[model samples]
Target: MNREILVENLIEFLPILYKKFFKGLDVCEITKQQFELLYCVGQWDEKPMTYYCSKMLVSKSNLSIIADRLIEEGFLERNTLPEDRRVILLRLSEKGRGFLCDQTNKFKKEIINKLEKFDENDIKRLNEIMQEAREIVTKLD
Candidate 1:
């Protein structure tokens, strides 16, 4: 297949996959944007709000609102850098970790249930393909 067609297929399929995994998801009580922010903090460790603004593609004001809400909800906390009081660091709290773990397990269970109909060979092939895709994506960084 042409690279353009392959890229197009990925673009098209990714949203379908996202919807399958995230649509109507109720494992967490947060909005999609909020969940994404939590996931980013959980995965990336301490980072500034600007970092998340870049990652989440939102304005500082918008992310601040999201961050404020998350902070209020006890999912995330901000710490002023001791060196520079102007710099703020964001990280997930224990509650946030628990929430992430619960949501992950829920997603895992849902995926496993969906995969039950597939044969072992098909599942193995899919795992191999997914790993290859992950490697390819990692190389883009």
Candidate 2:
């Protein structure tokens, strides 16, 4: 496929996939942006605010606002680098980890419910296809 066609297909497919299988699964009190920030922080250990700014494609000031809210809610904690007291790092608090875990399990259950019509063989094939797709997509990074 041509690059343009491939890009268009991805633009179409991604939202369809999310809406079908992942949308509304996060039945939490946080806003979508907050959830996204939590998800990004959950992926790694302590990271500086700058790291999150780049990863979330938000400005430093915006990222700080989200971080402050999460910190206030006890879902995240901020600590200054010991060596360079100026650099701030963020990490998930115990509550944040628990929330992320619960959210993940909820998503798994929802996905399983949606796949109930598929037989074992179909499910296995789907998993294989997804794994292959992930491997190929990761190469783009």
Candidate 3:
């Protein structure tokens, strides 16, 4: 396999896919970065701040700034681990979960609209392909 071509295609395809399906969707009042943070927390609830910094490839200070805004907005909660008071953990509040659900629904609807031209068979095949792709990609981690 041509690994260079595969890398180049992924680099080009990912942004295009994101732009078509996720970019510019209504995220209530939060910035895109804030929404992404919320999504990450929603997916990995009750994780330490360091986890987010590592997963998102952001600095601790930058993650703190984003977390602070989300906390003030009532979408996230910060807590200290009972066993380790110095470790700060983040989780989504009820409001954050609801907001994330709503945003996800909106994104799904947009993607559905874009896929309307595809026949049922094509859609099914696409779903299968995507699942296979996901399984293959997860090996990178």
Candidate 4:
């Protein structure tokens, strides 16, 4: 494959590798696809169930199944808006909030500390790579 394609592939694969290795996480728990869906949904500040399927690029049935598991696990909740009963809102539960807070902090700090073992130039190069990816993605949007 070409350099650009290899870069794209690595960009997508690295997070999965890190999650598996460092987090001691198994993709089969949520399944990798569901995990991606949940991550995208969780990133949203305002979540409407109606829009989640389209936004996450998940099928209606699959979204419903994921939602059902999330609800059952007490990681997500469905609520009716007072202004409109037809409008359903999705928000993280207390368990979800605490879990994410702890996990994200631990993950981020671990990455930082691990990468810190490298010298200044290596760190600078890492930051440059991240910035380049961000710029490319932002420009595409």
Candidate 5:
């Protein structure tokens, strides 16, 4: 198969795959964008609003609105830096962590159940192909 065609296929299907994977599974009722924010914020102990803006490739104004909504939804909390009160940091609340963990477990169970139908050789081949794809993707990063 042509590499360009393969890349185009991935580009077209990746969003579909993501939507299928995550749809109807957000027990906390957060939007996909909000869930992404929660996931990024939860990856670290805490991060400044600006840091998230850059990491998420969103503007400060946009991030502020998303952050505000997550805060209202009890998925995130904002705090001021002790040394610099002007700097605001975002962190996942207890509810946020619980939701993330729950979603992760759900995904794990679903994936495992789906994979169990395949034989060991098929699983190994899938893993090898996925690893190759991962390496290609990492080059873009």
Candidate 6:
């Protein structure tokens, strides 16, 4: 199979690892969608709604709906910049942060455990390939 197909398959499974491995307690279970979105937005301490829409390749209206749901669930908050009240910014809530910390730790452990099976050369090649992919994506953007 081509490398892109392999990457696509891996992308599909990354989110499932959270539900199947990182079990959340009570009503806090992170839906695959929520986890994916939070994974992107959490990178920015605070970011505009437009930023998320563009980054996730979703329509603005769709992003707005998801953002609203996240805010209602206490996972994220919508705030307006003092200088730009017309636009909104997204930030994760305390709940979101706590959840992400656990998720990140679980994700790291799982990933490292798998990667550790590979020799150092394989790990180095993976990093190099990933960096090349990032550079290609940057140019495309």
* Candidate with best TM-score: 3
Cα lDDT, all candidates: 0.87, 0.90, 0.91, 0.70, 0.84, 0.78
Report the C-alpha displacement of residue 85, candidate 5, in angstroms: 3.3
Backbone clashes, candidate 3? 0
Model 3: lDDT equals: 0.91
Across 1-141, the per-residue lDDT of candidate 4 in tens digits comes to 698998899899989757744665443344555555456557884477768877777777788788788778787788887888877677777776665566567667767776767899988997898899889878753
Which of 2 and 4 is the better model by TM-score? 2
In model 6, the runs with Cα more than 4 Å from the true position are: 1-28
Question: What value does the lDDT take at residue 24 in candidate 1?
Answer: 62
lDDT of 3 by residue, 54-132 (tens): 8888999999999999999999999999999999999999999999999888888888898999999999998999999
Q: How many pairs of residues in model 1 come into backbone collision?
A: 0
Q: List pairs with backbone clashes in candidate 3.
A: none
- TM-scores for the candidates: 0.87, 0.87, 0.90, 0.66, 0.76, 0.73
* Ordering by TM-score: 3, 2, 1, 5, 6, 4
- Model 2 poorest 10 in a row by lDDT: 23-32
* Angstrom error at residue 134, model 2: 1.8
Candidate 1 lDDT, 1-141, residue by residue in tens: 699999899899989987866666665578889988998998897998888888889998899888899999999999988988887789999998999889878878888887798899999998999999999888865
Which residue ranges in model 2 land beyond 4 Å of their true spot?
Answer: none
| Tens digit of per-residue lDDT, candidate 6, span 62-140 | 8887887888888898899999798898898998888788887777777676667789899899789889978987997
Question: Per-residue error at 102 for model 4, in Å?
Answer: 1.0
Return the lDDT, model 1, position 10. Answer: 85
**For residue 2, what is the lDDT in candidate 4?**
100
Which runs in model 1 stand beyond 4 Å of their true positions?
none
